[model samples]
Target chain A: MKKLSILVGVVVIVFGIALAMSFKSELCPYVTVSYVVSKGEVRNVQVNGTIVPNSTKILPNNTLMFNLSDGRTEMRVIYHGILSHYQEGIPAVVVGSYYNGIFHAREVLLKCPSKYKVAEENYSTSKVLSKG
Target chain B: MDIGYAFLVCSMLGILASIASSIAYLRGNDTRKIVKRANFAILTFTLLSFFTLLYYFLVRDFSVRYVFLYSDTHLPLVYTISAVWAGREGSLLLWLLYLSIFIVLSTRRLDKVTAFANAIMCIVAAFFNFLLLTSSNPFVRLSFHPPEGYGLNPLLRTPEMAIHPPAIFLGYAGMTVPFAFAIAATYYREEWVKRARNYLLVAWAFLGFGILLGAWWAYKTLGWGGYWGWDPVENSSLLPWLTASALLHGVIVEERKRGMKLLNYALAVVTFDLVILATFITRSGIISSVHAFARNKEAYAYMVLIALSLLLGFVVYIKRKDFFKCYHSYRLRERLIQGSVLIFALSTVTVLVGTLTPLLMHASVTRSFYRHIEIPLGTALVVLLGVCVVAYRESILRKSVLYSLAAGTLAGIVCFALTKLSLASLGVGIFVFSLAGVIQGYSSRKIDLRRAGAIAAHLGLILLFIGVMGSWMYESSYTNINMGVGQSVHAGDYTLKLNGFREVNGNAKFDVVAYVSVYRDGKLVGVLHPKLIIYNLMRSDRIVASVDIISLPLEDIYIAMGGVTPQGVASFEFYVVPLVSFVWIGSILIIAGGILAALQRREEKTRKGVVDAEGEG
Candidate 1:
């Protein structure tokens, strides 16, 4: 019984360490377009912003190009697949890497417009963090 | 609208009175009479409030705010009925209605233990009632009437809404019964544990099936051709069930009562608290999900509920310290059960941590993070499941162990050959071994509901693991395929040919369909028509793709169209997945097993009562 207890304890500790380490390695900060630009060559980060109107173009290969703005700055986003719910002036979270001033997105998630959702005037949380 | 609000307020008052009377009964100052009457009155009032809201929805009363926002005259009758619980306020009302009925049924006869539990439930009922009356009242009236109403979301116009939300809410409400009993068992005897076990099973079953139904809804909607996205809301919904799954194991082991009795009590409180946490995540919009709830400041009421539950759990634990002050050496069976419970707990913690990392760490972790930690843990669990079966070797055939190992090894070989992924093949081996343990439960003639239910549920679990592994590892996807009419493309070894396009103006919407045929080695295998549906009455301009899935004996073919142009050029994604059918089959078996295990046969009840009454006395 004591050995079993020790074994259970050991397994929990090992798994716990693995989970913590992987979580750290995999964590990507949500940043604004300005922050990404300031950082320069940011890898594995997500930027939350509203899609800029009349700035979307569908490449012949069905790749989508659009400009995303966090109000203060705009970054061009190059995505390789459909946005599925893309609309002008809609909030979106684009995840990938930033290099040479363009955000090449591996994934795009659009926040669908709803009567229920409160229209947040800002998507930037970096300012609040620095202030805190 | 006014009447509904009035009934809601009355139900809250009734719930408070019931709590007060239950306390009096526990104090020996009153009979269970007033408690029973108050519960019945609360139920009646809640029923009246819910029906009044449903009446407004059915009548399409545009003057009512909820009705005006969610339903229209053109909405189908079933969907309109479902729309009563579609929004935040309406869904809370639905949850409260189910809670009230369960509360009334549980309080049919109350002793000191039961009366205490009845009080705790009344407290829970009062909290929901208060939320409904103050912040989230579904009966709020509009200042002026509009000519028409904004119909339900195009995404919610399907038959899925009519069932999925309701089932999930029922599961949440059913959880309250066990939570109350677990708290009551803290200072009292073990009687509450036996009673609560059945409720736990039933609630756990409902939650399992509800999640599966949500997955089915997602699959039908064709989001990334994947049923699970590990979204925040999805993970939150899964969190409580994991803890409840722990409690499900804890209850059976705690019955010996050497020690570990407090385990169930603690797990039950945590399970119920996670339900509140799930609510907070879903409605408070603390995390980003495709099923985003609008963030409401008043939804912090649920945080208060969690605080209350925590306080309630500790206060009872402190008061009952003497009851749990004994220790005994654990048997091998008990130790094995403990090991599995620990695994369940770890899985819960991992999910809960992953879900909350965004809020606390200011970082987002994607599906890969979950897949990495969870798959290994799941494989370990499969191994633990095999070990745990040895504790119940009495009911199992000794020969079945050898048979299951052979079967499992064969499965691993086949998996290795098909996917060439060593990890999946390893999973197949352990999963089949554990699955054999489940089969061992059935091969014996002593197959009662409890044994059969456990076997079936575990069998479903093994099948689900196989389905997940196979579907993920073996599926072949061809994306962004643009084909003109009569054009063909190769999808793995199968050739997909776009045959033609047809438009049908159904009563609900205009359906633009693309006919496609699948051929293997130049012989036709199946025909598929994946359609793009544009609903006319939806408030939003959205075109939803209705996916086509053909289930073959060995594999399933899935197709979804992006759109079809006027010139008959079709763009779509084609996918074929091996063993995806096991996900659904496993889900159903798990769900049915939960309900079956909860059933109380006639003879066993009397015998159990006699045994328990003497033990406690």
Candidate 2:
């Protein structure tokens, strides 16, 4: 019984090591452009995109529909992040390589409308009117 | 100037003290001074670390990147405490603190036998504290400070999230006690093994409750109606649980029969080892589950080293001829040993292989490794479990083969008729077998409460299996047209009439409520109000499905609305699941049985003159 147990243990240990070794290389891969990066940095580029209402069920996290006007192509980007309200139809940049035929965006930034300018103008007008 | 560095230094000192004191105490040397110092150091370090993390969260210390990332000023007090464990570093620190606290508590009231136990506790504590200092230190200072921190994960903001990890950590860390006791028992005479059963029972209850709480949290929080997804993280938790459960039962046999001593010891060692391995798999990011931490090489190295040391220690203890000779041997014990080893071996293999297969498949050497290895291994596990059940029953019954076959066949037929399930459903078959095991207890005249609890647990498993199988196989789900107010849709045998959707705005979020009426077979069933909640900070949306369930003894009609489209149509999905309630019912029974088993009468003679000490070494 002891010998058999030992044999089983040895077999499992070997298999486990073999399994670990097999996955070691791919476990930590270099950040490539096409890997949809979420909330992290990649190579040096800062990429961003818009959250579009998706109809496909296969997209588990939902795809971000972005337009690349420079390239004149509509790009469907798959990203994993909590999409904010300003993220839709806002100018954004993605900082990753287009790898495996998909554009991977990392560190998304949403451009906000000029609410500060409007507030400043309103404050000045109110002060001038009060003086008059 | 930062609390992180101070906490780190304190923990490192605590680790040194624990190790030194443990060695001195175990050898019956002058360990009192060092042990006292270690106890105080551990308490001071843990309290300081905990409070510092809490302070970071409460103050919304954006200067500390971790706190800034996981907490915000707007976060509630409950979620603020939870944010302490929402990240990799903080979670590890929490584990360390909880383990140290438990060790200190357990060591305070120790008998002479508990000296060895205390030493083992100190060793385990030292391992964790060392891990804390070396890898994934929560006290690591931020390179740059930010004005405001990122908030916690929207999903983790649930109440269940607050309790799940802590409960799991308590259970995982609690297993160290029995492991320490096992090591301690090896030094003492055979009588210590009998006394260790009570401690083992306590550990078992903790681990079992923790696992259940986790499953409950997952079922409710994950938005997936089913529990037990067999995900790698879930499997890692279950692996220790399975071994611990088996060990709990085996200890009962050991205490009752004065047999299976070696088996009991082996179980103790393996259960402890599995706990470490589970922690490693989860924290080291060997598995790619959402719940697991991201890859951290230092954390991985620390875990591997700890795991290797524990493994080596276990191997040395088991292989030593003196250790075997210390306990009396029986020929009948061989079967139990074989069974235990087989189950343990199979579980270890299944978990290790299942967890690492994805990584292995992705490795450079296995560039062509396209197929999944876990499926075949899982199938093998199922087969082994089947064999174990048969063998266990055969050993107990010792009946004629013909009679056993006849009984099994009759039981199978009755189970089939009762369940009204086809043979194609393997899950149903397994559930039937579990039920049969429960019924088998009726004929055994030596029916005690513990045995009954065990039987109830088996019955619960059967119910759970049936529930999962029924929900998976026979469930009917379909999405209908998105409806407006006064719009109705047909789903399966039910027509869902959309009463209306009302949007309620709150202080921090807005909730879109969908009220719908269900009519099954032209008879009014009920109304369901599902909501789509939009949070303020992240502006993230979550669909909280409100299910109106018509539960029966054999089946359930569960209904939920997907939401109304802009076109004024309400979309609804109705699920007709068989034996769904039984799953939750079974889980509750299993938990209750575990509690009962934990409270089982301790062997009366073993409780004499046991001394409780103050503070663990």
Candidate 3:
């Protein structure tokens, strides 16, 4: 019984260490837009910003070019693939890298702000809903 | 007073009734009478409040803010009725309504066990009532009604809404049953564990159904050709579920073997507390999720306080040594059960830690982080499933061990040859053990519902794992292409030819549909219509992709149109996934099995009564 307890303790400790180490490696999650901008050229950075409406252009090659603004600065975002929800003026989170002043986005998550806000607000009117 | 005011008054009355019930239980005099009255008052008022809200929705009363926010006058009647829980405040109220209903339904008899459970439930009801009354008052009146109201999110306006959220809330509320029993067992000197088994199984089944429903909705509407994305909100629900899964096993060990008593108690309390944590993650704005909730510091603080209280209660209970002591020896089957429980415990911690990481690092935990844990841990779990079955009551003999290893190796070889994917091959190999386990369970003569349920549920789990392995291993052919009408695109063995296009206009939305023909190895398969719908609303313009899918028994051919340009060029992405239907089939089996197990011939009532009476002595 004592040995079993010791075994359990060791397993928990090992898992705890693995969890801590995961944060430092390439397996580390993407940083936010502010974090990426603060530390230039970090790969797999996740930044949240609003797409500048009317500034979206779908190139003939199917690459989407749009301008994203984080309230302070606007960065050019170049993405390959269809982002069906990339409507104008909607907040979006882009996961990828920033190189040579352009945000090379791998995945673009459309944060359709107002439509979802109404539902959340009707549920609890305390805090304003945040852009995902 | 208006219905809204009356609703508020009723919830307040529920609070008073809860307090009265708790006091009566503590005093141990006429506890049954007081609890019954309290239960009646709470349920009646909650039912009235629910009906009043439904009435407001049915009439499209734009004067009510919740009605206006969720339902527009032009909305279809079905969706309008379902929109009652489309908002945060409405859902919380709905949760409380389910709690009251469950309380009324579960406590069929006025016994000591029921009274104690009811007292605990009252406390939970009081808390939710307070939350509804303060932060999420469903009856808040608007200063003025707008000319037109915002309609429900086009995503949520589905048939699934009629059942999904309600089932999920019932499961969440039903958890209090086991929690009450666990708490009572620690202090009340009663045989509460036996009674808890039914409620625990019921809640577990309902939660499973809710999750499956949500996944089905996502598959139908999200146009992603996938169901689960390991989103924080999804993980939050899964966290409690994992612990609850462990609790289910732990309680069984406690009930029969007189072991894992403390572990069972801990799991029950943790599962209930984790539900609060899940609510906090969704409602506190602590983490960003697709299902976002309005952040309220007071609500978040209340959640923390509740969780802390439960934690403190657990700590105090564990201080008593006998509760934590194991009274049985570590036999082969016992070891397997305990080991599986331990694995589940580890998996739960990993998920909880990953889900809460955003709060710590201020960045979301990536899917890869989960894979790092899931890949290894999930593999171990699968392997252990086989181990438990093969090594079940038999001693660790060299011959049997070799036979098990030989079977696993053969399975691995067959899987590798078939799929040509290594990780999937390993998963398949482990699944063979699960199949054996099921066979063993059913091989017995005159199998009862208990044994049958366990067998069916385990087989379902095996099928689920196989489906996951197939999809993960074989889903490699995919492409994003833009082609004009009459142009063809080729992806591996399949060729897609754009045939035609059409436009359909609606009152609230417009759809642009593209007709595409699919050919496999020069043979015509089918024509698919993939459409993009753009919703025109006052607040936001939402674009949703309606996917066209060809679902076969073995695989699914998926197509979704991104958008069409003015030059007659249509952009669409297509992919094929193998054995995805099995995920749904397996989930159904699990739910059916759980229900079957819970409903099987009631545990000898007189025997249970004798045990309870003896325990009391």
Candidate 4:
């Protein structure tokens, strides 16, 4: 029984590791870029770029956009979700395939500067106005 | 006269007195003289350092560089005093002071012939003082003093910041007591492990509370909606905590059955090593963290020297096992001891590997040198732990194995349903392990409450894991709306109406408050007021979300919004978190159980009989 339990534990652990590796492979793919006349889906490639908000001229609608520094490559993301508290000058990670000259990001990660302000003050009020 | 110079000289003098007294006691026949003088010197040095730092902050002395960088006159008096520990140099000084004070208190409380313990503690105190006097003196002066000092970091000006660091330092400094006792146990050839177990429990409690407080501060203040990023600094604190936790359990085995004596000694040494390592990781710029202090080469050199010396002592002591072998003849119940040792070794390895992985990756070696290091070590650790919990209940291997499987399956099912199959299916695995924990707890008849605390803590980890998984996977969020004072928006089965926003100006910050009402299923549930703060000193801003929570037995409806917009539209995010409160509540129970275990006096009537039985076994 002891041996059986140990074997089960080991198998469960190996299963977990295999699942992670496969998930990573499927989610991350290498792709080569082409100056698309239209949209294209590329596989397994790393893309680096800076983030710019869409409609920066308006108040609160500063939806994040990735301005790829490599030539004129760019992606405007109308995120199907909420905008995190990320701003300009912060680093971001985006993973997805390109569609019709635009990068359709499936996962977006933003690393914001750690806030060191004391707890008493509320920073959310300014966030609403800024979000607009 | 420079206050910095005065304090530096006083600290040096106190170090000399402590060392001289400790050596005298160690070498001489009479220990009373050395012990009394050493304790008094430690107290004097602590008071002197405290007052000097206080004066620097209270007077807004910009001539002192530490003060100039971390404090200002406009800061509140409470925060001004806390500014003493708000920066690197001052915090190191605080660490030294706390170390000395703890040593002195421990000396006064001990009545036994503890010359060896006193000497070891004094040496540790001397090392900290030397570091302060030479490398990271808080009293250093600036060549050109500015008129006003830079204010404390806006985040650190909170009450939690003031309380948390001191509590953590106390916990860290408190480890020296057990370290000293262990040394004394080795020197005197006595079973001091039993007595020192209480100190270990205390240290564990303080460190546990300190970590929890830090997590709470991060959750509410950072506006990150989650706690615990598994950052290096957090992991560093956790390393000592993990070892100390294992040692706390190991000590129980030693006290009950006189097993794993050598393992106990190694744990004590490692616990102290972790303290030094944590300090080194935070103070040195080797790793980037939210709490990384300014790097100083002198401080780094001092820490390296101390670490090397402690490591050397450990090696020499372990090699000459002759000193620790006097009690080796007494054996513990083999199965219990083996199970406990396995838990300790597994936890220690997991923490050590987790802490060193990033460093190994960034080392100035070939990439392949560290390629195999990034495996999901935490997952393996949790599984091993699951096994241990199941095994702890049964004396026989067969019974334990059968019980573990049954419990694991039930836990897995519950976790799957709770997490709602978000992201990776890891929650199912974790849930199975946690279910085993509940079963293990129920099966133990002779419930060692300390063991109960350990079980509770494990259960808490499982709940926390589930909560994090559910929030990450199944949780949905969205933002972008323009609403007037009477405008409304629908989110996740709820409608939020922007009632209004008001501006509130405090002495330290300006707040823009948003008031919003929520209706669920056409019934008004509650109101939430989140704010955005503009700190006057740092000229920085942060978004503070107000959350109105309707906590059910199984899940929580957490509503938080940024604030009311200029057009009266309020922007908000709501989270339907499952089993979130269990994480916090379980942690409290764990701490309470630890305390209960610590206070339960050993059954004095059974002690001599157990000792005799150990001799026979």
lDDT of each candidate versus the true structure: 0.78, 0.57, 0.71, 0.59
Give the Cα-based TM-score of candidate 4 against the true structure: 0.75
The best candidate in terms of TM-score: 1
Give each prediction's DockQ, rounded to 2 decimals.
Answer: 0.36, 0.04, 0.31, 0.12
Q: Is candidate 2 or candidate 3 better by DockQ?
A: 3
Q: Pick the candidate with the highest lDDT.
A: 1
Distance from true position, residue A99, model 3, in Å? Answer: 2.8
Q: What tens-digit string does per-residue lDDT give for candidate 2 at B185-221? A: 6655434555555555565666666667666655544
Supply the DockQ value of model 3: 0.31
Candidate 4 chain A worst ten-residue window by lDDT: A118-127
User: Model 3: per-residue lDDT, tens digit, A21-116?
Assistant: 764442335344555566667776666677888888878566889988766667888998876555788667677889887889987776553223
Residue-level lDDT of model 4, residues A1-132, one tens digit each, is: 376459557855664565445334433422222222133655333333445544222223634444433234455433443443545543344456666566655544444323333111012211211232
Q: Of models 1 and 4, which has the larger TM-score?
A: 1
Each prediction's TM-score versus the true structure:
0.92, 0.71, 0.91, 0.75
Report chain B TM per candidate.
0.93, 0.79, 0.92, 0.80
Instruction: Give me the iRMSD of candidate 1, please.
Output: 6.1
Q: List the residue pairs that clash in candidate 1.
A: none
Instruction: Report the TM-score of the second chain of model 1 against its true counterpart.
Output: 0.93
